[model samples]
Target: MVFTKKKIWFSSVALFILVYSINFMGYRDYFPLFLLPVLGILMIRSKLSKWFLITQIVLLAFLVCYCLMALYYGYFSFFAILGRLIYPSMFMLIGYYVAGFDTPKNLKSFSILILLITGSTLYGMFSLIKTINLYGSYENVMSALGGRLIEDLWGNSYISATVLNSSVSLGLSLLGLLFIKSNDLAPNKRILKIAILSIFLASIYTSATLGNRTGIITVIVSFFTIFLLKLNSNIKGIIRLIVFIISLYILKLLFFNLNTFGVRSYWESSFIFSRFENSKVYDDPRYEAWTTIIRNFNENLLGGRQINLSVNFAHNLWLDVFYDAGIFPLIFLVIFTIISLISLFKLLKLELPNIYKGLVIGLYTAFFLTFAVEPILQGFVVYFTFFCFLIGIIQRKLTSATY
Candidate 1:
């Protein structure tokens, strides 16, 4: 059956929403298991570029070599090695299929769908918050809300906020960038757009209230990145952005005092004040992990150490990959990242719609920033999958434009 491009795009969007919703509902394992076969079928039907095919071949080759090394050394179980390969493979296949049907409108639609899913998850978080009393401490509130506060090896506590919070923050930040860059909306739709923007901003505020530092950081960094990227070309635009940022800070201070919004206290307690106080005591786990990995380099230079060598994640993507799969796979990952960034940079230079470009930049930067704090590539497979799909869509657009 020949499906129109619109039909295919809509189908892909629906599937994405379904998978994300299931993920938010705490069925991440089962949903991906079910979704992979469907994505494989879509990939089989999609026409892919030669470069994409070559890239996949290289990635697969690296995975094969890594798996063989792991088996040879008994470093990881068969099931463990297979699990590591599955997500990236799923990302490549689903990304190819979605890219085949990508269009500016489809991208916008998919982004809005993500926002809606984020809204649902935010509502769930709020419901949990409501069950706790006003006097509850942050730890108590977060404990009631689900997700644990883990202590690193050095005895520093870290909030491992739920995936839903991170996803909501990511969606809200991207949606904000899209809204700010979109100048072509109908004049009559101004109020509607403002309402939607307000909702997204409120969700961001909710993320802060829930002690999800990553979400708050993503929103701040994304907006700053978009402002600089979109406005740096003109003197007036630069001046306007500066004034806008100043005014925003002033307003934030005023609201912070009034506590008119629930966001201020939490933001102050969780991020601003706590971060400063903890700075003297908190030795970042990522730094420690990287140090340990380097110290053990000779032991795991070609083949990784046995899985029993460490019970904790490396907490940095590059370090994690290097520790788990050895130097060859780490080299392959670095090469893949460099190539993807070059392609994305070229796409950014194109005459695409501002909102589309902003979305790509925002998502890419946010995802990359996450690698410094978590082994996102290994654990947050769903987010990584979406990032890969966006990469593929951007590549497809660039290819079409060149032709």
Candidate 2:
């Protein structure tokens, strides 16, 4: 396919996969810096649609949230709210690119593009094992992997792996649907199959934080949706699901630790908040910050904003909203999200291609979990791209007149 200016216009929304795909090379490095121009490109050419209009309204509502924050707390706190959007907005641009790939043939082409990225992830895991570098406890993990800490990819034990997990899980789950549809894939197709399995296993073996759980759960939800909706129609799906369950159980025994720190912590931190809010641990500061947010919201629920919220996102996405903006924008965000979800659920009823349905279901589940965990992660890139794909798929359904 030639690089046409029209198609390339949506490259910005492709920002989520591209940024994280590069991050597999270096987390918190120069790649994020390069995303700026790509995002700027999106700003220029992104055409307006219902999805686009909704997102803009949501953001505008959030700005009102910021106003409430400023008036109540007398602190202009919009940047914190804006910061959450940086990555998500970039991802929304990718949806525009997907919009162009609306046909079955184009879907196949786009699937290849996704696989190419997943392929790099397989290589990254091997590179990690070959040249691992460990610091502190990571050194111990490397010893466990039998490569000193040198097997540590990018000097971070799980960062690269976790990001790849998100990309590969979404990519492979989508591809699996396609593969199941055909008995005669190309000669090189086996490599893609290997890549999918390898990345899936790697994601399980790699130690993960709370973020991993969201992706894991998302994949499960997506596949199950596919299974219920399509697997019953094909015997291969039953076999694939049995293998998947067995594999995840086996990996859980080898890797998944239920007692890990942040990953283990429940959303309700009341007891911890009571005890540690009085102690010097980071938990102590969280209450103060949370308190700061609530107080501000009460003062100006309409026009508020938060600035320079301390390190590592506020954990609770809704709380982050109350802390940064205010309540009303939060309401708008909720409504916007509800509408998109309803749109997809409606699509699932149509007798569309299982491959397309699986991809959409899996991504929707994953991003929903992500939203519960992280505020900014639930932004434009993920939602926009996802819905745009749905829109394209929906267009096909329209011609079918499948209500």
Candidate 3:
């Protein structure tokens, strides 16, 4: 059947909502299994390049072998296994299909969809905060919210959950809003734009609410990187930097001095603050997990091995790939990332809208930061798959001559 733009639009939005809801509801390993037929339809309609297809096939082949091993070892059920396979495949197909939508109409539609998704995520964050206020601690909050609680080896409590794909979605959505400027809007509509922007900006505090330092850091770093790229002269850059520092200082003073709503104490009692107070920057369970995985490298060098739930995967994307699918798949992962990054760099040099450029930088930082620390491939595939979708956008921009 021939696919019209309207059909593609509906399908894309439907797929997006389905995937996001599955993740948001914490049904990653169960609900997504049923989406294979939908994903199969997407695969049939998606037009991927030879390289993405080849690399995806090789990567999936290794993952398939790994999944079989998992099954043989009774690590997960068949349905869960199917869900695992479908998540990455579905995102890749959707990425390919959506990335080619570079027209103004498509961008506007995507902006609306992203706004709705981000708004929903904000609501979830608010709910989480309210729950925390009522409970006073994240312990046993998993039932109320949809996240699991964990106490580390150091006797510290953490609620390692987010409204969307672990705050990466929030950060990227904000960046997308920043980049996709609606400059032509009438003056009367500017207030609405500013209000939306304000809501999103305030949502950064939601990172603290979720105790997600990575999210906060990625957003800050991405903004700084974008700011640096926009600088045309050293003097102007320095002036801007000084102004930014002054503004931050003023905000800091206002923040610390105010205790009107008792929000400061709540923030301090939040998970992110607790982490900063209790742990050093390098002091994390992931470091030990990485060392242990490497120490037992030979055990997972072939068909890989089962992962422990306590520490999750290796918490490093490449190491997890090596530990789960063995050395061959790890090599392919490196190849895939390198190719995407190279293309991203090439896209950066092209004359494009500042919004897309900011997205490229912000997404790059967010993806890398998460990949370095999170079990993205196994537990948070939505984040990485979304990164793949951004890569598809980058590829489209690079191939387009009219931009």
The root-mean-square deviation over C-alpha atoms between each candidate and the true structure, in angstroms, is 5.9, 9.3, 6.0
Q: Candidate 3's residue-wise lDDT over 1-403, tens digit each?
A: 9999777776665565545633444443455456568668866876666656765675466557656655665656677666556566565555555556556433432343354345445544555565566667666565655564432212223435632335424443354335335443323336545654664565565555556767767767777777766663589877977897799878766775684367677778777888678877667788878878777777777644544434757788888877767777676677778877787778778766555565567657767877887776566555665665556555555555255
Q: Using alpha carbons, what is the TM-score of model 1?
A: 0.75
TM-score of each: 0.75, 0.56, 0.74
By TM-score, is 1 or 2 better? Answer: 1
Clashing pairs in 1: none
Give me the runs in candidate 1 sitting further than 4 Å from their true place. 1-9, 24-26, 32-45, 65-83, 103-138, 141-165, 175-206, 252-272, 280-282, 303-311
Residue lDDT tens for model 2, 1-403: 8878745644543553454553455553234446687657755785456655565456455545544554456543345334333433343444443544455333443453354345444444544444433333434554565532333344444433333334433443443343444223333556645655565565434313212344445555656765666666678868877887898787665554553344334423433333333555345444455566665556645433443445434544566665545567668667656666766777677655555565566556655554454443322223323333444434334334332
Residue 4 in candidate 2, Cα distance off native in Å: 7.0
C-alpha lDDT of all candidate models, in order: 0.60, 0.48, 0.60
lDDT of 1 by residue, 1-403 (tens): 8899778766765665554543444444445566766776767776677767766766676667666776776756666666556766666665555555545444443344344445444543544344333426556654654544322112222324444454454555555454463554223346546655665666565565555556667777877776667784899988888898799888877887667676677656664357445654247555666777777776776755533334377776777777767888778877777767887788778766565667667767667767656765455545555555555666566666642
What RMSD value applies to candidate 1?
5.9
TM-score of 2: 0.56
